[model samples]
Target: MLFVTRSLPSPIWLNGLEALKVTGSKGKGSTSAMIAAILRQLGISTGLYTSPHLLKANERIRIGDRLISDGEMDASLEWMLALRDSYESRHSNDNFGAFEVLTGAALYHFFNQRPETIVCEAGIGGRYDSTRVIPGRITALTSVELEHTELLGNSAELIAYDKADLCPDGGTLVAGKLEDALLPRLRAYCALRSITFVEAAAEISELKYNSAMMQFKMSCAGIDYGTIETGLVGKHQARNAAVAIQAVWHWLQCSKREVEEQRFTRAVREAFKAVRWPGRFERIAEDPETIIDVGHTQLSLHAVAETVREMNSAKPIMLVTGVSYDKNVRGILDELLPIATEVICTRAYHKGSPVETVAALCEAIRRGIVWKSADTIEEAMDLAVSRAREQNMTVLVAGGLFLATEAFVHLSGGDPRLLQFF
Candidate 1:
């Protein structure tokens, strides 16, 4: 089960690469970004590698907040692809996919850059995620759930066990809250592996949020930080911040780096203010107050709905949603349909569940609620804006990351790749 094949000079590719692997069904991206931000603020050069880029492949790799340059990407991809071709020539049975190639390239970039720290987010369930190939010093799990049932497992505890497998032997594992049923499984796994398990949520309290920012206090890992403020919205984000703080603190300890109290506190404050992970409760418009959230899961959608309700009291909320075919559409709609003034369902400018199917699903769960179907996301946005102006409602573009990414590009008028010119 080697990721970097021996045919590709594995020693040069893997040696001296230490990482913090964060994996779960949700919040992995934001949590990794938060850790990278805090590390950078503490004056450590950091490399962050995430997945499912919104616009460009280069978005998956970064060094100190700068995406890998096109020149660097070209060079790395060329080298990796050549290695893949050579390896396949000899061993046809084993091959690499696009994600594997990209993951290797990101690791190469990080190794070359020699960042003091690297934060890697798993593309899927963590037991065998490509990011696990890195010599991770600390592992962080961000609220696991029953996802990737075919690959991970069918139950919550099974899924937790799969993610728990990512914790390196003798390495520290930090995690947020989990289902009560999964705790025993996690405890058993950690005890078997002799991994240090720290529950981050236990140290989190007084999580309060407004439209602009969330405020919370965290006292964890022999480091007590009071009244932390983050620009990331929602109560879940506060928990995520706590997880990031604990994970990074553990990394600091393992690396034997001293954290000056005043400087570290200031770094936490500045990191939250500067942290910018897009497509989660993002505001795209001002007049009608259009917002976008990539919360396809029921729990995440519930949090999004709660945040939107608290933010918009004067105006009714209209939902423009497009979800993937593989998602639990009924579960998500069941949580969100009742909160919207009207629902406009459509497909993003990418491959997904057809807009017609999504519309029908919405209709079944509408329960006399107002709803309509649009052929494309553009048309859906148009209809939503027109209706919002007519009815004095706010527009919430949600349900899937593809839809949210499309909305971000469309609203910003920044990327031509998302423009579907059919």
Candidate 2:
């Protein structure tokens, strides 16, 4: 069944594609993936839709932990293109963008596959996000921060509204640890809408984490999910998982499904232990300990810094970093420079910030921070890894998610077509 919106193709395709939508400037992808993983472990057929795929576009849409196959994705795209052409032919002076078409295509494909549940991560803000068409039963807002100011607004409160507004009226809303200033607005929004609001941070206690795993206990709606362990490292992931656990529980409650406490606990533990959200603090190699994280913003990179600090490794930390052209290069560099023993600035093959531009910025702020510039990401990775091995230091390759894609390809010996935009 092809769902169609009156004015656009997306809203129509989203009909019956109900999901738990998660939105934020950061952590939403990980949070959504965690929710899907837990549900899948429960023997539920689950669909997870996330954004900015590191390798392939199909990676953005998954069924039961497997990405949509190339053949199926192609078929879905063909169907969507037909609808797009029909819409354009009938209505002049209007055309859909890539995301709008892709959203419709994803929903259409999911309709055919008919997963028992879906967890979708919104692209950009919520109210107008293409994924918003899903008519979500549960909404999750991860930490709100300043981002996409031109289109989203200039303040944190506005961004929070765009995200929090995704929560369905009279449905469930689970949130991560938000800024103090954002809480009042969110609380008022939930209260006005009669949303059953739960704070993920508040429900979590006895939190403990290491480089390899994070452990925590979450009490959701007075239901204590005993000690949960997630393979995802860093303190931020614990918070993300907490939000996912609460959101999934609330969604289950909405579905009126019978909940077996022991079974639920077991499923959650097993899922977290095996759940893998690639490019988020992913360890690519053992020698010199190479790591890659798709942390583009300062708020996101802070977690990376904190994780490195907590490690207290005897080895030094070397960084290979770059950013998208649209990102705040200086801000990201500021957060990274102090944490690195040495830095190699480079540009990804895509429409990244100019290599010379990043090199110049790094040079200006060097002070005592030894740094170098590379013409390409490969050169930078090679140099960083070589130096790291020689010095017995850990290598962190980070920046935009695109950089993560490149690093993953280079380190894993994956196909080059994985780098192509879908």
Candidate 3:
């Protein structure tokens, strides 16, 4: 359905957001949730708005770790429903779509509660995403990669421009370290707009113990905020944390010099643990140590493969996988196959993929990888785990989120916990 946001009145709830943060890229959902969790620990009422809910649509909007009450959601829905005609008329009978309606609903919830902060995940490309309409007191970009090419753009430069679109006047703009190709465009854009630019890489050094997280003091506007550890899996997470920490402290100056380095560090540590962003390389079941990652791009896949190898478990690794029509599956497999002991390909379109074609491709690329295919996600998962059981091996389930995650939950008795975070 058409869920229009612009035609609707700006809710009074928008006024309460002392700090507004937006997370971009594949990790947007997890990163945004983590930001909210940290603010909540400091006893600030925080609202979160994310998209493409896994199991239920209600999961899209949350306040302080809980889904909004049904009554509140329904009331908001009714209001949007009533305002539909006016929005359509304004757009020459065109109305807001699904994303806009939910975003408006979330602002309605957060603003009325007058939460200490709001953490938002950009649904599509940054520039045109419904969330961009909100004036972010602080904006953070996750590592941008090629995504939604038809809607956003085909090149990294185009995508970067789309991401930089969220940099409204007077808003502090934080960018995930731009890829070599996108960096020049992003920098130029920031200069043209006079947006306060914060690059994730310039801060924290990677922590020695876990190559995964980085510990660094965030210095903004001559203020130094103390260090905190990020538990996000990839080396990229260190970058994501840098963007988040900077944004948090940047907004801190909005009121009091209340948070110094020490307190800020402490709050971030608690926030990292409290943030239970799921699916991105999560070892949800450790007995067989099953892994689920939603790494759809070549860069993301490379990151996942590197981390799995770093885990250094003696257990021989077996991979369960899937992908999209546009994804570089052959290229991703080039990075993924070296570490895997065997490969099981599953058709995963949700609607499904061509199982045999996927299997054939896997076999051709890695001649002796024991490549095989299954008719459905469940069957493919069963085959992978069953083989792992026989070999006492480890299973890393990944491909597209639609393929690996759905399969992992189905074989694990279809648990609801899978959707709660990832």
Q: Which has the greatest TM-score?
A: 1
Taking all chains together, each candidate's TM-score versus the true structure is 0.93, 0.92, 0.86
Error of 1 at 172 (Å): 1.3
Clashes of 1: 0
Off by over 4 Å in 1: 1-14, 202-211, 221-224, 310-312, 414-422
Number of backbone collisions per candidate, in order? 0, 4, 6
Predicted structure 3: lDDT: 0.69
lDDT of every predicted structure (CA atoms) = 0.80, 0.80, 0.69
Where does candidate 2 stray beyond 4 Å?
1-17, 203-211, 216-223, 414-418
Candidate 3, residues 1-422: lDDT per residue as tens digits? 21433343554444444556575656677667767876776777777887767656677888887888889899777776667655677678566777777777776666556666677888777777778767556787777777778988898778777877776766677777667766766777877877777776545443432433434444443444455555566556655666666667776775454865667767877787456666677766756668788777776787788777655667888898777666777777777888888988776646334666666677787887755777667777778878888889888887676666586678669842345432
Kindly list the per-residue Cα lDDT of model 2 for residues 87-145, writing each as its tens digit.
88977897777888878778767877878778888888887787776766899888888
What are the per-residue Cα lDDT tens digits for candidate 1 across 1-422?
25353434446535555678898888898999999999999998889999877777888899997999999999888878887787789898989877788887886677567787689998878777877777776999998876789999998888887887887789888988788777777888888999998888637677676665677777765677777777788777877888898888888888888998878878987898789887778776877788888776877887788776655467788899888788887787777887888888888766568877877778888755646788877677878888998899889988887787776676676552444412
**Error of model 2, residue 389, in angstroms:** 1.1
Could you tell me which residue pairs clash in candidate 2? Answer: 3-12, 3-13, 4-12, 5-12
